[model samples]
Target: MNASLESTMRVKSSTEKDFLKLSGVNAVDVGYKYVDGKRTDEICIRVHVTKKKKTVYKKEMIPAEIDGIKTDVLEGTYVPQMLSPKAIDELLSDTVKYRPLKGGISIGPDRSVGGNIFTGTLGCMVTDVATGKPLMLSNYHVMCIDNGWHVGDQMNQPSLIDMGTHADGAGTLLRAVLSSHVDGAVASINSGINSSAAIVDIGNVAGTATALLGDAVRKRGRTTLLTYGFVDGLNGTVNIDYGDGIGVKTLTSQILIRPDTTINPRFSNSGDSGSTIVNGDDKVIGLLFAGSSSAPFLTIANPIGFVETELAVFIEAGLQPNLSKGGLENE
Candidate 1:
């Protein structure tokens, strides 16, 4: 780490807890400061607030600078990136069922709430470390839903919420990791179902890489399809609402992404959770899990290295798309 990052990390380590206790503050991290919507060269501590207020109590007021380092307050409400029932219906017609499952498509557990099934995107394909079998990767909230969901629960493509029925079964939940650093899970693909290492429009992942500030990134997701962004922050901690059973949780050491204005204004949206974030070289970098739907549209993802270590699975990549069993054809 450089001097600026090191200094910011030290300040964050010493003051993060106090900042989190303040009302309206939801996350804290180190990143380049922005002025008038343009990023500056200076590194500062970023504070993500659910909403910004014109006036606040003295106790809630965030300082302009702390420990000689600047601070920034961003407004956004972070939640687990899953589609609501109404949103699922609107997107139903477009959710295609891929024969040989690949990365970056609709998928979810067989569970439901108020008769509407849950839905999220599949992140990628991986090899089970213990069994060496092909398994589909996605968020724990998408595959397992809650702590009550057991191993072997069924998963579906296009998700059951997106007009996919039980007949569209694609895999079974094999493992999940809802840790401080990762919100990932893997499912065992059904025997007849084929899977490819290729992401929907991004082609095959070359390998895994570490994301650095200002690095260009891209992802294909269930809701947004293909979009580009930039790594704007790192080693961050954010609070996310994972619904009733899981409730509010804090995730640490996350990779933060901001929209790439040249391509699309928005990055990941709801139902885009579990999308794999890749660097410009097509190397996987992070597993997208949460984000704000509003301005700046900051997306939060778990570093792929942390996810792999937490879930004990290796993301399979670098091979050409397989052509057997009516699976994906390489472009």
Candidate 2:
């Protein structure tokens, strides 16, 4: 059901205090828009906790705001603290939060989070433009992360959404699951759009996650969630300006995300490229394709609009990705 987007289903008629009591769960029921302008029921999966954790570092509740809406922001500065369901409750104040995978409370006993962690947008959709076919895109890479992104590899993406009580927005919800791979999940999700990818030159990637210049976007990575920022003009386009000492190739994006919007912990980290990128109102905006980890390490994203058409074409082709052998997909 709508479990990936933990916000899709929440305790009904919840108050700030109610959400404050938030802790992770396996499954629950939360409704979205109703038929007669009433509340309807929907399935929601609580953020899962892993068991590999050995200790809890830091766990403290902090007060913060959600898009001008006052709320509490809980922090887990250490490994074990990251997966605290109660802590997650405080952070997900009517919003989705991607907890770290290392936290044992969220992992399946049979599964492992070591090789690479996993976290994806859980409330968005993709479609083909030409044939109007529908697909759910994440990233070709997420399917198989052995050395290069491949087809037939398993991955995760958002399906249902509940935007929650916002000004001039509707709450949405859906259900979905993640396997090793999907045939055409990329084309289906991207719908031939590149809104969520960016430039990648090494460490197992090609092309860039696409995004629009000056577009508002959110990234759900393995180590963090809701990392908000905007797209800039640091692309591969070649241009020579005889005006001054303006040399190109200096890919740059110093765009600042509102501190309130930034995920205290980045949802995804080094091995989290195919993670979902969303926009306001909980729509798929882009995918977290690339970034750096140095002083002022800038991040880069891909624009979905660029390849939306191409994705549409693939969606029409009807490729069913199966991660049969995509180079040890975290096995």
Candidate 3:
């Protein structure tokens, strides 16, 4: 290995465990060192931060360099734990059962706690590159229960949150990746179920687009459905609370969403966790996952490119129909 790579590996192996245990620090990773905005072959430490002020001032904190490798710090707000609940009457209604299984619809793991329902949005439909199988896309927390799940676990549309019970199994969890960089998962769609590439209220997706700062975007979510927003920041690092026992997890390389306040102040809510972010032209940009608890709530998402690469799937465009399903159109 190169000297810098060797040094980075050694430093991370020696200090990663201790750094993660520190308060206000959210996550840690290894990457190429950058100087004056230019990439370098040197290895470096990248730290995710929630409470920047507190972390920078902590006594006996990790130094700027360890074993001659530089360190970089990224700061972002922490997300709070909250649930979005639907009306009990709606959950009992038959309309939800009849709704098409498509992007931006409700979905969740087939598990419950003391009768409480958990639900999130289905981001989109992607095809496995290796097998060419259709799969449902969503956040790891939304579909895999933040790593508290197993392959073959049933996935329900309308989620238990919307009253989808075990009897209403919609799909099966195929894979999941819950790391500091992403929170994404996929599931095999049940046979005979109609899955679409169209978003609930946003119509058909054109294609995948890169997220640029200040770009206009929109999303159709289970809660706060069909909201518009702008890409406020990129490569953000934030601390996200995944509830009790799971505690807080740090996310890096995140895309930030700020709602179009002049129109509607909220970009997303709890149940909107798995909604896909799209540009005005309906091109995929990112996968929605978490947001702040208070006003001017900022939304966080994983970049679309990262998600596609990590999941080994492609978020199909509306024009491309599933050839295997008799030309079934994508929603």
Candidate 4:
């Protein structure tokens, strides 16, 4: 971590709880702040208050500096809204078939009924470290029915959202790890189903790369198609709203992507969750999961290295040929 970021995080960790205890503070993080028209890194605290509530807390309740690091207090109404799936699978004709399965396509859990009605993106193809079998990767919320799924559940391509009814079954949930820093899961691709390790728009991912501040990256998702951005934050923490009763889950050590304003105003949007983030060389960097809804939208992702270690799988490179035992050839 850079000196500025390290100092900012130290302040965040030491004072986050104190900030949150205040009536209007909803979230806290480390980000850039404009000081004298120059961008300076600092600890950012989000204070959400209605026009009426703002009067209750005195200015002293929010500090302008903590531990000598500049503190930014952003005042806005912070409503905790639930996050819904963004991928809206285009309905295809019953006769229309997806010839080759690849990353950046629709997929979802196979329930007894209405399995294909909802869908998420297929992140990429990877090899299971234990079984050496080629498996498809995606968010647990996308493939596991948002934590209600079980092992051996059927998964389908072109998901139900794309009209992939029971007849279009494609794979089975192999393993899942949703209760951690990442919302990830994998499924075993079924026999005779063709799949490619390459991502859409972006070509084959040669390998994995460590995320660095200011690195250029891009991803192809089911919703927004292909978009590019730059890594703006590291070792970051975020709170994600999983709905009313589910509340929020705190994710740590996350990579934050800000849209390249010079190119596009946005990076990823709804339904783009589970897309793989890769660098200019097409090397994997992170797995995209969430984004901010407001302007200067930011995309959040789990570092690819962390995801691989947590899931015990290796993202496959190039095209993967069908193996009788369902294993990738090079592995």
Candidate 5:
């Protein structure tokens, strides 16, 4: 790491509280500075806000530079990327049941409280380190709708939100972790449901890796399908609304992504949660969980390393089932 970047990170940590207290501020992180809409080599402290106001109170104004470290303000309001009832209703026609269920497709809890339906992407397939049982990965919010859900709660592909009452049974929740850093969960694949190791559009993952700043990445999600992006910020601390009793959560050490304009305009959208983000080499890097409402959408993910450690699962060295006939194949 460059000396200047290290210094900027330190300053960002020391002054994060004061910056977040400012009205409209949503997150704080370290990233390259941008000038005239183009990325610059200079590293700076990034202050993400829900809205970039034309003017603000003198006390709430963010300095151009903090401790001689440059600061950039970005517009963003992060929220869990689960499909809403309105979206589900509109996308009902797009839902399709997969025989050999695989990554990048829609999945959700068997049901939601009060008959509500929800949908999120099935990230990928992995094996439990302790039990060696096959499991599908997703988000805690996607698998465990609320505190009422337990470890054995059933999950469905195409999701109840997408397929209504016709959704088929898929897996059962095995473990989940919602903490200061990660929002991840895994479900044991039930009998008769064949799952593939490869993501829908992306090929078999090479393995896990640390997501570095500016690394080109992509994800196959339920709503967005396959979209390209790049890591723009690291070690981000942001506030996310998980809805209802779960409420707003403060997530730390997040990987921040910005859309790759040359390819896709939006890297993620609602129902993209639980998508696995991989680097150019098809190496798993992060787990998509939340994103901002910004133009092109600013995707947020927990580092894949953190998700693996927290969930006690190994993704890269796990399953290697052959893709079914007429199924996705790695290039």
Candidate 6:
């Protein structure tokens, strides 16, 4: 992340040279412009900055005010990468650095999304399955409002909670890698990411397998990074309520670990929607999403197969090519 780039926007001269001078900025461009009766307080600036560089893939982002909100975007062929929990935390702490950065990855607003920087508890991964293209994924509702691409002046990424910063005391910092733009349809699928993802075994249970009651498991969340718990139940369901009169009810659950009131192993509160939930063996068993408060409550996670299936469909459709070549060739 180099240094945190703060500020969602700044009034800059319409020249590329002027925008580059903004703190945390890498570059700038204009996506569109409109002055309406409702846009009295809006700010607009098209800026670009380098986010990732792999021998196979390199990318940049531009800042634009979407509906009066200052934000970065991935247009045409760009991808969104992720920052590790430590990196994100450090940047968030340095308001000056974060504000001037001039760009950020967009999380989606699928029903599965809990929250983001506004509420913190979100660190994400967006990846291409074919050649293993990379991205930092999150609930988009926080990144863009209804995916309309609104432009405006703001303090930070929409709805991002920064749970690490808001935490009361010492807490674990999660790690995540950001790097690419995911297919817009990834969130539209009911089954979650499809089989396009490599079935890497980090712990137990193995891809989509249900865990026995009391099995120890851990998961890596974009916001909280990694946390552990025990499988509490099977074939369970929870009715989770969210803002906008939206929520997931009778939502399926593959794990029900013993409540961790003492140490809060679950990674997200409300904002870490869609994070991966794995067993002790490191096999992602479910998607760690809606919880009571980014920490407690009987968390509801979607089946791993669901996510894989969605990703697979996007891959087969040739949405985004995995520039990394599935790690077959190192940069």
Which is the leading candidate under TM-score? Answer: 1
Model 2 weakest lDDT span, ten residues long:
100-109
What TM-score does structure 5 among the candidates reach?
A: 0.93
TM, every model: 0.95, 0.34, 0.72, 0.81, 0.93, 0.39
lDDT scores for all predictions? 0.86, 0.28, 0.72, 0.68, 0.84, 0.33
Whichever of 2 and 6 has more TM-score, that candidate is: 6
lDDT, candidate 3, 1-331, per-residue tens? 4465556656765776677677767656565444664445555776655645643545637678877778865444445312434444432222165234678777877875445556778887888998987788988877766445789999987677676788878789998887777788999988767666667678778879887766899998877878998876555556678876577777766777878887788898777888899997889999988886554466888989889998899976764434344223223
Ranking by lDDT: 1, 5, 3, 4, 6, 2
Least well predicted 10-residue stretch by lDDT in candidate 3: 86-95
Q: Which ten residues in a row have the lowest lDDT in candidate 5?
A: 322-331
lDDT of 4 by residue, 1-331 (tens): 6776676777777777666565545446566554553445443432322222434446436666776776654433221111133323342222223445677776766663233345667888888899987789888667765556788899876666566687777789988875546878889878877667777677678889888877899987776677889886666555566653446676777777788877877786666678889988788999888776665567878888888988899976665544344333112
**How does model 6 fare in lDDT?**
0.33
Supply candidate 6's per-residue lDDT for 146: 30
Which ten residues in a row are the worst by lDDT in model 6? 94-103
Judge candidate 5 against the unseen true structure and give its global Cα lDDT, from 0 to 1.
0.84
Top lDDT hit: 1
Writing each residue's lDDT as its tens digit, candidate 5 over 161-265 gives: 776354478878999999988999999976766678888878688888999888999999998889999999988999887777888788988999999989988
Clashing pairs in 3: 196-331, 197-330, 197-331, 198-331
What C-alpha lDDT, on a 0 to 100 scale, does residue 209 get in candidate 6?
50
lDDT of 1 by residue, 1-331 (tens): 7887888988987888999999988899889898988889989998989888998898888899998999988888887887868675455433888867889999988877556568899988877788887778999988887788889999988787777899888889888989899999999888766678889889899889988888999999999899999999998999888877889899999999998988998898889999999998899999999999789899999999999888888876586544455444223
